[model samples]
Target: MLEGRSCLIPRPPLSSSGDQESTCFYMRYGIIKEGSEEEEEDEEKIDDRGKRRKSQDLVIASSSREIQIEQTPHERNDYSSVEDLIAPIGRDISINCLLSCSRSDYGSIASLNRSFRSLIRSGEIYKLRRRMGIAEHWVYFSCNVLEWEAYDPYRQRWIALPRMPPNECFMCSDKESLAVGTELLVFGKEVTSHIVLRYSMLTNSWSPGKEMNSPRCLFGSASLGEKAIVAGGTDARGNILSSAELYNSELQTWETLPSMNRPRKMCSGVFMDGKYYVIGGMASSTEVLTCGEEYDPIRGVWRLIANMSSGLKCASGAPPLVAVVNNKLYAADYASKEVREYDKVNNSWITLGRLPERHVSVNGWGVAFRACGERLMVIGGPRGLGGGMIELNSWIPDKNPPLWIMIASKHSGSFVYNCAVMSC
Candidate 1:
């Protein structure tokens, strides 16, 4: 596991060279500039939270606070020591392409809670595998026809996994097609536009479980405790669905839960604080939505929460990234570069760190959430203002507050950043 580091600096541009290729890519903090007394004063003003506002230019410092790198490439290299020392794999390490990018957008990544000191520097291609919970040893999902691919950071090359359930089509269906708990669970498929198929991951392979009560697709599914919850999506006939169900793995049965107040599909669903949050999705109009809601299984009720600051339309649905840290829900909005942290206690949301870039599609928002020891690793996802998926970064910086870092991905035009941080 990557241990936490202390010194902080603004997120660096992800391009091969730190230099900006075009105005399209902007830095949250740029150079402090020369002889701007007023600009320096403007930087000191505190906003509502008393935190200093973003400055057009910022200085980069080493942990010792002595070495400062201000818009200089060679000087920037000096700071790499601290970053390289703590990274899971050195910045230049190649990785294996476990699966193709088409099948599974959110390729699975986990920390061993142990670091590979000897091999990391040896430059040998090796896979550092971690054991997930009891049942799920590996999990990968793709909604596209092509196989899923991922960079094996240790190997420093790309690799692709086998096609999912040959002849069985996952891309065509809408049911909650994601892995949760210890295994990847495929709940239902939009078969015949009315019927749905049920499947679950067992021993690295997917097999049919049982058919769902109804056929639906493009919905949200999450695993909390022993129950896998499937919620809101469009049915086979192309009608939006508000209904939800719980699949009890122990009993191999599906039981209907209280449906959502509104019919929706593509909403983000994550299990946090013993409850599930289904947020931001398309409505009947097929337009993006900002409404948010929470479901408590124990209470057997659903309660509406504060709406998102802005609407998230279908062009960009919330692709997971909804994680719980210290009991708060934090997620990156696909439509917006902002990563919002939800306050369950206060029933509100606070903006965390900005993504540095906003993803525009389901594939672009495919960033997976990971934690190496104490350092948070947000891998893959797209880049730029236009939504181009690229594998990037494994570390999030802290001094800037929300811990944001950018790294490149192995898959072309596909990026991943999952909020489901799990323990193996």
Candidate 2:
């Protein structure tokens, strides 16, 4: 009934010894005038008087008699309107309120206005969210080569990502994925050399990843916050390596780190108890390693832990499938289809329970075991189905044994080539 008129939503006046004026934000539609014919018609259409009162309560006339209609220059052609993110409420306060919003709503929020779109795309909001300890974990995985998808467990929704740029050589090659901050890095070999592909949630696009100082494949890698550590993998020459590197997603750069005491390949990395651990790898083609190394970022040193992964590895199996949740290390024993938890006191593993019966893996390949927030997620599907189906099962660790529950499933290739969990 108040169409085409601007309405003011006032903020409560601050209580102070000195007089403090209150501010209000403008809404595109104004309130219905009291005693107007439109109000009477609207009241009759709405049966609940409380509902009508609540609707009218949202708008308030200001005493200061100052009104503002904020507008910013249209820097880009795609923007429909160049208004302040939330006019009258300053940018800082507006961002603070936005920070508390669910990340799943970001796509819709970005579409609301030009300033919001810019803020979300600039990646500044995520950085601030990290600082404020607001994080949402989303699973990113690949079933078919060059195709990736993201699952938001909280919202129970799947987000399809842009297909990776096509390259026959890279498609057939072995690949590794790590999700750090707002970026997901996929490492693989082209016909002639190693290559890294990065997917960004902010831009919702893929681009060439920054190459490492020493490019290697089949490395042990894990991410904590905005940085990730990659260590102990074979070089391009297929020689096992002890060299390591650290990557900062914000700066999009990699720094060479001190090498481990031993060279290994096909190892798994995890962040536990505020440190990075490289567990269960092969020193050579014939020698399997049970020892794990712990890297202390504060001390800038790697401490070797003997027999740390003694019983976790299998003969000729993929590197120990491991994940860390709530600073506790856990491993998925694919051969036995069981889960084990690490005891830091004794440096041993305790059998927790079995993985989901439907979860299938071949020598630890094709399946993904990852820590999603506080839950352990197992991603895979049964073997030999005419049309494949991927299932996502998760269990929260507790005193009671793990109770695997199906979070979601979809018709896709049963084999999961690479997977990573990004929390920001």
Candidate 3:
């Protein structure tokens, strides 16, 4: 095939006014066309689509025509601080929710910061706040060395309170112990068995109360209204005695009551309705005790109730269960761990439930009560030789088992003679 050869193209030349002319090369791909200087100046100012265009200064750019839009800041004159934003303005909000929402508030944030700083500076606020929610129980017990110990259930710990001001003689020997409100009333001393010592848990302090009519110890102490009644225990010479005495809290004095049929010591006492029960303990001999009797404070007389299946002895660390529920008396034998629930209507002892776990040495004094959370907490015995407290719990089974969680263990000097529990 025959073909013509292509030729080279020349660009337009520059003008003479000191401005160099642009090299206007008419190019189509690689093919270009030569243009004369006059031809370029004569060409009209037209776009490739044959549209007229304004001069550079008068031309409006498409991008510039677009409206300049922007988002404004959320400025609120009504709210001067974060607290204004978070605080409830007549709004019904839960305390928890309000607290959460208010945490971000300026005042709350600042206060929290200041509190943390203060706690760090004090070094005790954190610990105090941590213990604010601890569940606790207080029980009084007497040991040999440690005259008295108070067991707390929440920490499962034992705290040794102040001993009697006097450390010697029969002052340490509390033949009978009774809990009146938060104060522990003990009757019987060496000089005169009728002397009484009242220990207040709130103050963790002690004070001397009035003495009984006769010198007595190891007696059964009970309460009727504001007055305290003491039944059989022992005489001044360590003899099994059948004598009863009464102490008037209002009068701050003592009176005597009719003695029991037989002399007894370490007997279990329970006040139900308006009557007092002196359950199985022991006579003058070391033999076991099975007989039980009740006394009416109103009538000033004693009536024999149903006796326990097993005799309760003082050697058992603590006395048998003496709980009054729904105006009925219930006794628990520590030796057998068998609980006898007394039906007031039938006037008899029936088998109830067993303790989840058995306890070790009981301190003749045991404390028990129904706590807020549907649980019954029981703290027993002083720390034998070592100063400590044993605590336990009871509840309906299949749920969480009632447990005795230890809160405190310490070197309490001695285990006193009597023990009882009272709520603060």
Candidate 4:
């Protein structure tokens, strides 16, 4: 791909009489020629990496010492040369290619000029990635009171995002947060009033999201297509809610859905098998639920599914530690520190395998055990160890005798409460 090719370097004609004349300079690869005075002046505009010092491939000195130097291609002030060749492949394809580029390289690309910055900021590149079936998932977390961070799995590094909106408001928890397309919806509260804040991957900033029809906390949510579904949670009046709603990103609106069969709070929600499944939570102050309800968005109906007791058993105590792999649902058992896959065929819970031992309690507030790609990744910390350190571990269920692999370890004493994956 780096091999030599003949290219034409175009320039304005020397003599101009209110007319445009073009001159073409044909050059072979690996050959450097003395550029025009204007071209030499252009080098000053580029950064040090683009600057090429004067060097001749073959040189003769007055002392009769001949010097041979290796020369590389000179950097150009114009970026259009590459774009002209790339544009013909189609803009959508071009955008997809750009999205596939290394995330760290984005900093340099975005530094090119206003146009490059605008393209990256528009989030269109991510949209194209989704359409092309090449979207990469980034794991985002609210590690501190109001601070949040995203980890690029391919790059295996943290991506800094803008601070949470409204300054004092913090990310609520797993129950109310879900990633819808390129946006992360954080269903948090500004004091007693619940609010939704959307973090846009394209802009790297947070903005106010459409308020939910039923303002609540400790609710269940999940993303399917461009929409997010929110089910049961405690309402503003300190009452449990059965009301449900869907936030459609395309229309930028939230529409009410039929209420669940029963009121529930602090439930676990996941989109699987073409339905939004709301798992166990608190039925009332005196009772913890052992039941679940599945909603068919197309049919607009809720059906009580099997495994009410089995599903709610692990969920009732803390935030539901559930994930999906190969279209099968699984939940983390904090007592055993093992992942249990729900046997839909038999309506039972079976142990998949043990995850990595944790320094933070798996039952800690905001711990996340979610699917990233085909693997289940758990993020939590500071329980068994000191110094507020958080650790990340991942494992694939399909692997023969699944094993937990430690992927990242960061010593930050911040309370990381929730995490979700955003495909962009």
For each candidate, give its TM-score against the true structure. 0.54, 0.81, 0.54, 0.76
Give the per-residue lDDT digits (tens) of candidate 4, residues 1-424: 0011111112232121111111111111001122545434433454344455443252212122333434333422333343421233434444444555544355455444344545665555555545545545668887776667676555456655666755445533333567887678877656567677887655555788878777888888888657889898887677899999998875778889999998988788988888988988888775777778999988999999755446434433675678776688988877677778887878788776775665446353546788876678888773556546766777768746558776766655445667888754
For model 3, what is the alpha-carbon lDDT of residue 179? 62
* lDDT per residue as tens, model 1, 72-98: 333322322523322333333312221
In angstroms, the error of model 2 at 132 is 1.1
The ten-residue window of minimal lDDT in model 4 covers: 21-30
RMSD of each: 18.8, 13.0, 34.3, 14.1
Q: CA lDDT, every prediction?
A: 0.45, 0.77, 0.46, 0.63
Give the C-alpha miss distance for residue 194 in model 4, angstroms: 2.1
Q: Which regions in candidate 2 have their CA more than 4 angstroms from the true location? A: 1-84, 383-387
Clashing pairs in 2: none
* 1-424: candidate 3 lDDT, tens digit per residue: 0011110112132121122111122101111112434323322222221223221122111211422222112221222233333222311221122222211121122222222222222323222322332112245666544366554332233445565766444444455667653457765566633566777432345788666667666666655334567777777777876777776654567787787776777666666777777776667466556777777777878776545425445554444556654455555556666555565666566766664343444433444322212234344434333445433344422223233443333343333356555432
Instruction: Show model 1 residue runs off by greater than 4 Å.
Output: 1-146, 149-162, 171-176, 187-191, 194-202, 286-288, 308-321, 356-400, 405-424
Candidate 1 lDDT score relative to the true structure: 0.45
lDDT of 2 by residue, 28-68 (tens): 11222335675456434433443334322122122323234
Candidate numbers sorted by TM-score from highest down: 2, 4, 1, 3
Runs in model 4 with CA error above 4 Å? 1-93, 102-107, 165-175, 309-316, 362-366
Among these predictions, the greatest TM-score belongs to 2
